[model samples]
Target: MDTILWIIAAIFVIAGVVTIVRGGLIYGIVLIVVGLLIGPGGVSVFS
Candidate 1:
């Protein structure tokens, strides 16, 4: 389950990068932030 979340976070980060490159700055930023907050390190906050 943890590994799955990590993988999802990676995908979100990657998608965020693509969004930024495609001129969706706001969306990209949101995606990246959400990705970070969902990643392992960020779990401490919720935990």
Candidate 2:
């Protein structure tokens, strides 16, 4: 389950980056937030 969540989080993070690069900052932020919430390590992913 944790692995699955991690994969999903990775997808969201990638999408967020793509969105940000396209100038969709709000959408990117939203995706990143959701990704973190659903991620295995949560905020620790950044650490």
List all candidate RMSDs to the true structure: 1.7, 4.2
The parts of candidate 2 lying over 4 Å away from their true place are 43-47
Model 1 is weakest, by summed lDDT over 10 consecutive residues, at: 38-47
Model 2 TM-score, 2 decimals: 0.85
Deviation (Å) of 21 in candidate 1? 0.2
Q: After superposition, how far is residue 8 of candidate 1 from its true place, in Å?
A: 0.6
Give lDDT tens digits, candidate 2, residues 1-47: 77888999999999998999999999999998989888978864544
| Residue 5 displacement in candidate 1 (angstroms) | 0.8
- CA lDDT, candidate 1, residue 19: 100
